[model samples]
Target: MGCVLSGLKWPRTPSKDHVTPEPLLPTLGLTPQQQQLLIETWELLKQDIAKVGVIVFIRLFETHPECKDVFFLFHDVDDLKLSKELRAHGLRVLSVVEKSVARIENVTRLEKFLFELGRSHYRYKAPPRYYQYVGIEFLSAIRPILKEKWTPEVEEVWKVLFTYICAVMKAGYQEEENKHNEKTPTMKRLEKSQATAM
Candidate 1:
């Protein structure tokens, strides 16, 4: 069951091209005026997503000692100290999705980006399921700082963002599987031909 679940795709990439078209405004069940207010609130918080990333990393390491090895592998760091390039890369990635948080606009481009990201993540061998854990931790870290500014509208935006990201990863995994399957056919044929010759 774990293997089956793990095989399922989750998108980890964010794309600028795929904006959620129908804005998350409606999902919050708020009036247009209220939605506008929520958008403004999100704008303010969005600027801090990078900062939130730092806090999330800290809290994650503090709570999950065993997980430190995974982080080290993914980040190429024996300790918590992140390099400037790594920090910049993280901020850039977060910024891409943060820009999409206010609305549900472009689905296709977003999905593609996420798919690529998921495929890339495989190199680090980070547990595929850890995406959700990171998302939850990110929200938890920022929620308090956001205080009254954190509206349902904002949360809805995050939901869409995460959902889109996970979808991409799911697709990426399937693509990987398909590629492997393609190779297997040739390998099996070769094995059968050799057996028959013997």
Candidate 2:
């Protein structure tokens, strides 16, 4: 026992890099059953994330052609050139929602995250109302995939959750709009002063 103890080495500190990821979001507004179903559904979809992403953007374009003009990435994307850019954009958007869902219990985190999303989206000048189509099209994309498991209850659950998500995002959009308006004349003056200095 004494010899074995002498040979052993133990560290006095835990590794800093071993921080645990934050636990998945709480059920929040949904019931326990609803939360379980959603988690299961997301597990299923996440397995085929790339494919679902492809389906989402494709459906978005099919349903709302005008949404294409809102993003600069879509400007050069003709019908024949859909897959590459659309797939990348689709994955990015879905990833954000996945993170939001993971932190569902943390409404503050979700709102802050999406608020930044909306604020940045202001650069695209995308109308706030247009984001509804994404929820619609994403549901349409996932419906057939979920098939037999996709019940009316599932639809209602997603509807409630996404509606909340969109509302938070819209608040973010409004914040950016307010700042933009506040900067109106100051932005012009700065530009004019820069021209004079040059």
Candidate 3:
């Protein structure tokens, strides 16, 4: 079921290099019925991930050129393959969430999902400030397809997703800082010396 939903392919070799970790699922705080609905929606949307990935990548590239460096760090030929894998994973996750809660009848569960997603954005190392841009781009990209179908529910889902994504990024940054602080004496000394000289 996981593989089917993720569109995973078999690797030729068992190389340990450049492994991207799977994303953590957002806690939905849902009822049993909601959980069933979520699963159904996810299953339905799994087929659309590739198209969604392309749209997301293009939109990010076009609207946030500054982010190219971060995204392109893995732009090498081999890394391109990995990038595609990562993008597909991201798209699958997004599609599941989008479809699951896009028209949820319960506002509280809906809001909870949104809040967590906003937090996840920060956790995923997305830039803290650019979430709004991403949000706008996402809405714009989907708006035409969903024209006249848009509702407050759809808007709320996006709001939550981007907000959580940004939050997740911010958390990642903080975690990075914590790691940096845990460096050995030599590294700390070097950093301190550099700071003093500057």
Candidate 4:
């Protein structure tokens, strides 16, 4: 019943001294070619960003109904596809992606923006786990729109970008949550117990 590799001790590839340290902050870690691919695809995607946003959220809700509860605006609303609020919210989410792409050359700025977005999401009562789902839905939404232009390389670059974004956002959410918990220690303990019980 246990993992067979649990007792295995694989040798480290670079050894301690030769291994390069990771950056203190998350990095997009994209190569120049990947960056170019991202920019080129974004050019096509930007035009359909609004539509893509709607599609992303719609698919997300269908696949993960729990996510819909995070959005009070559309939580009780029927017909998400026809909901004006859903369309508007989707646009806002896509706008953040557009801004992140625009600031790709400026890592500090992009990270700050995404981190703040994560903090804001915490205030909106959205859990950090849901962040990854957004990225998944975003890929699903854009793949068909990009059509022939969507290659494996393009997908790789986009995944790098989302991975970076989600990491920073999750950090921000945890930070904000810690600050809130500091003021409500009892609730923090209760939440921990509830989470563990689940």
Say which candidate scores most in lDDT.
Answer: 4
**Per-candidate total of colliding backbone pairs:** 13, 4, 20, 0
Specify the poorest-scoring 10-residue window by lDDT in model 3: 73-82
lDDT of 1 by residue, 60-79 (tens): 66666565676664345544
TM-score of each: 0.59, 0.76, 0.47, 0.80
How far in Å is the alpha carbon of 68 misplaced in model 4?
1.1
Order of candidate numbers by lDDT, starting with the best? 4, 2, 1, 3
Q: Which 10 successive residues of model 4 have the least lDDT summed? A: 16-25
Worst 10 residues of 2 by lDDT: 19-28
Name the best candidate (by TM-score). Answer: 4
Candidate 3 C-alpha error for residue 179, in Å: 2.7
lDDT by residue (tens digit), candidate 3, 1-198: 465645667565768785645344343344555444444533544466565555655676667767566554433435333466657655754664564355355545554455455455545655557656655666665655555655565555556555554554444554455566679999999999999999
C-alpha lDDT of all candidate models, in order: 0.59, 0.76, 0.55, 0.86
The regions of model 4 sitting more than 4 angstroms off are: 1-24, 184-198
Model 1 spans with C-alpha error above 4 angstroms: 1-42, 73-86, 99-103, 185-198
RMSD (Cα, Å) of candidate 4?
7.6
Q: Which should have the higher TM-score, number 1 or number 4?
A: 4
C-alpha RMSD (angstroms) for model 2: 17.0
> Across residues 28-66, which tens digit of lDDT does each residue of candidate 4 receive?
877777777888899999999889989999999899998
Q: Could you give the candidate ranking by TM-score, starting with the highest?
A: 4, 2, 1, 3
